[model samples]
Target chain A: MDIAISLPIKDETLLPKLTIGDKIRVNGELFLFRDQVHKKIAENDTDQLDSINFLGSGVYYCAPTPVKEGFLIGSFGPTSSYRMDKYTEYVLKLGFKVMIGKGYRSDDIALLCKKYNAIYVITYGGCGALLNQYVKEVKLLAYQNLGTEAMQRVLVKDFPGYVAIDTFGNKLWK
Target chain B: MRQISCELFSNTLKSLLFETQYFIPEDVLENIKECYINESDSISRDVLNNILQNAKLSAATKLPLCQDTGIPQIFLELGSYVYLNFNLEKTVKNVVNIVYNEEKLRSSCVSDPLIRKNNLHCYSLHVDIVDNESLKVSVLIRGGGSENMSKTEMLLPGTTADEIKNFIVDNVINMLPYTCAPVIVGVGIGGTFEQSSLLAKKALLRNIGQRNQEKFYSMLEDMIKQNVNLKGCGALGLGGRVSVLDVFIETKPTHIATLPVSIVLQCHSVRKASKVI
Candidate 1:
């Protein structure tokens, strides 16, 4: 059976429907961050991230171009996720259920996703401009020193992606 | 001798850098169009559509084609007859700064690769001098996806062609969907260790679908493509015939006792542009 869903998903909603090989298209704001922003978040204890409700939320491993005069952001796309694997368990604990990025993940992270009933999606690696159009709105959140790797809240519409690893421990590609 | 102002050189560099961020080079665009029209799988087709649309939108809206706008790499062939009134290195730096600062392209360069600290706002530039009166520059916006997949090896003189092919094929299969497909493979052979790797990168700068001039190198290109495609890492590695868009090889003379090779993968978004002044 085929199922379609929207973004800002709840853990229960994702845990049941998505399986290996199932495609997912999310319509919600995607946050962009790379190594620097992730490192900062990993080192911090204040829980500043609590303000953002991640329950069933998706985070794209990306460092976007700075916003120009009229646009919300520039050339937004996914970066490799392996670099951020260390923080996955913690973020999942915070209620962020889905992660979007390119490349493979550690086995521990995959197991964690299965335990937490979360999913990891992979988008095309170099399709930044193509992916940016889906971003409806973008707000700069934090990590100013990081330049392109700064954290920003982004709203996306019909953001197309494929499930690389799903909640049930099925991997789409070996 | 003709005199060119520093400002002119700087501005020209700026334009090339900024324009290259969004615009797909003519050859790359054409090759992708061919792929889009010929691809059989619906999913792959849709992906191609997204890529094509992204290119159009990026060009029209002046947004970078990808977030990893890549380290700013410049290849220049400066003419001997032209006199530069300003420092070439400073001019290049100034242009890179303007593009990254004002244009808002991602700063891919970091202070330390191991430490992973972003070096404020900086980009990478490679300069070369050639015999010419007019400056010819090629600006390549290389994504990290492909850059990370690059590999280098030093083999004993007895390394067989079959072994070389297997090594490359093994790397490609292992990468699977990670490096993104269909990838453009660039192989550099016969140079010293570092030289081979640089030649591999330089090979990637060639226009997509352009064949190598040497007959043997051309055959090697064909051999690599067939071997890689047989692995079934298809388009996006989802399983299809178009695993690789093309394979390019560049070679140089090497030591009698050593054979070196470097494999550099270029993702589907093969971005590069050139300007002559």
Candidate 2:
């Protein structure tokens, strides 16, 4: 089943409507963070980090190439979800409601999602070019020195993906 | 001796980088289509369809096919009779920097492994002198997903054929979820530790589904392929009939004491290109 989802979803507002293997077209804000952003956040590098108020927001694990002449974003898509497994629990603990990436996540992520009533969305792994059109707007938020790993606030429209793990701990990948 | 211009090589490298990233090669595209036709699982088929659509879009748009344009490894076959006045590494670094900026590609390479600063030594380069009077360059763009999943093992000289096959099949299956399957497996067998790893990487140069000329190695490659596909890890490891697209194995004479084997994984986006001047 194909479902339409808006980001910054409230507590358990859309949990029952999502299930493993459900295709979703997402629209709304996706807070973008990749390798170093997660590292800095996990390290709690500053007091500023502690006050980030992205509660009930969608978080995407991706870092696209630089924007060329005229584009909202570069070739951007989900990175390998497993590599960010170590930082996932800590970030989720920061009150984010949705996680988006590609491939498998740790079993702990499934358990954590269940415990927190959160959802994990998996998109196409190596399809960044096709996925680039979803970015409606993008703004760099922090850590420009981190290069592509910098944090950004991204607005996406009709972003295509699937619910790989639901709030109930059901997983799409075996 | 024939003299070649430095700008010629630099221009070729720039175009190759763009060409490879934008267009999925004909052979690779054909192989994926074949796999899609044979795929029975609905989810796996959908993934394959997306891959095709992505390739079409990448070429049409001329943006990069994947966000990770990948670490470019340039291999040069310099003709022994050809004369070149430039230093290879410095030239590559200079040209790659300019080309990267022009294309607005990501700066992936770092200066020091520990310090983590961006540096000039971005591409891995290997040059060999050949008899022909032609300079040929081949570039392979390896993304993080498949490259990280690559493995190496030093088996005893006494290890049986079945053991080698099992070693490769098992590891690939286990790493499927992370590698972005279905992947093309490259195996380097029977060289010194370093040479074996090189051979494995070079094996990716083979056209997809092209078997080794020797019957024994060719059969071994087929065996590994069959075993992996039978496991049904499928596209993106989402459970399907095709986990591996193909397997290519390269071999060299090795020391009697040690048998080195290295497996390099190439994801669905098998980006490689070559040009001669």
Candidate 3:
């Protein structure tokens, strides 16, 4: 079904409503993290990560261009999700129900999502300028030293995406 | 000898970087539109439409086309008779730092791969000295997604074009969705291991929708392009008829025992800008 749904961070009810191929409009807060942030969160002390209170939230695999003046944020979009597959179980276990990224997810990650009652969504790859319209605000949360790969908390309105993997293991790319 | 000031050069680089990141070249844009018209699959067509809209929005807003602003790559065709007032390498890096910060482009470079320390000021510059008196610089914003999918292979001297075709097909399939199709497949054949890869990247700098000057290589490009699209990798690799927008091949004579081939895949954005000064 071609339906648009709103998904807020720290919400669990939206996952069940999403199925493969359904267009989603994520309206709420999203935590932005990429390669370095993921590795840090998975390997380092969890204190910094725990402080964010991202449990039951959506984690967006992305990095933004520098935030320009008078704008909430810079052009922002999803990075490839497969690179984050190794760390999926860790974040999913942390109660992240919504994983937004781009490209296909590995079978293991899909299985993990099924086990954890989480879902994987895809934003159009390389559509950063268009996606930036949804960003309402941006805040640097932690790891400022990572520069671009640092963790960021962003508030988004009507953020467009598509469900690539459902909790039931149905994958749109497959 | 012609003298160029560092300030002029830096300003030019900055402009090129900003313009390329925000705007898709006209030829490339036109080719994508053509792909959109010819695409039959609904999903692929929708994906192409999104790409088109993304280009429009990027140009309209003066924002980056993708969040992966990419590592800035500058290819300099420096003339032997031309002289720069300052150290070229350091000058380019310094200019990149100012431009990236001033333009709010993302920093994707790291101080060390293992430690993963970010270097916001880093840029890669490749310098080639030519006989002419003009300096030409070509800039490409290579996203991590497609850049990571580049492949190089060394085959026996007798490796056939069919084998090369299979190799290209296999890599595209393996990199599906991840590499971001309708990709431009740049293939380099018959140089030393490293040169082959360099040629592959150089091939990407060529104008889109244009074939190699040599008829033999052009035919090979067409053959590979046809075979790849037949794989149904489609737009964004979501599945469709057009997996590739174009295929480019660059070649050089190699030693008798080596048939080195390198492939560099460029996503649909294909952000490139060049200037001859």
Off by over 4 Å in 3: A9-14
Give per-model CA RMSD: 2.5, 1.6, 2.0
My TM-score estimates for the predictions, one after another, are 0.91, 0.96, 0.94
User: Docking category for candidate 2?
Assistant: medium
lDDT of 1: 0.76
DockQ head-to-head 1 vs 3, winner: 3
- Clashing pairs for model 2 are none
On the 0 to 100 scale, the lDDT of residue A27 in model 3 is 79
lDDT of 2 by residue, B161-243 (tens): 89999999998888888766778899999889888988899899888779999999999999999999998888988889988
Q: By TM-score, highest first, what's the ranking?
A: 2, 3, 1
What does candidate 3's lDDT look like per residue over A1-174, in tens digits?
A: 355544454456657767877777787788898777777667855677765666668899988888777678888878988999887787777777889988877889778878988888887788898888888888899888778888889988878777788888888763
- Model 1 C-alpha RMSD vs. true structure (Å) is 2.5
Candidate 1 lDDT for residue B210: 81
User: For all the predictions, what are the DockQ values?
Assistant: 0.64, 0.71, 0.71
Docking class of 3: medium
lDDT of 2 at B167: 94
Higher-scoring candidate on DockQ, 1 or 2: 2
Report how closely model 2 matches the true complex, as a DockQ value: 0.71
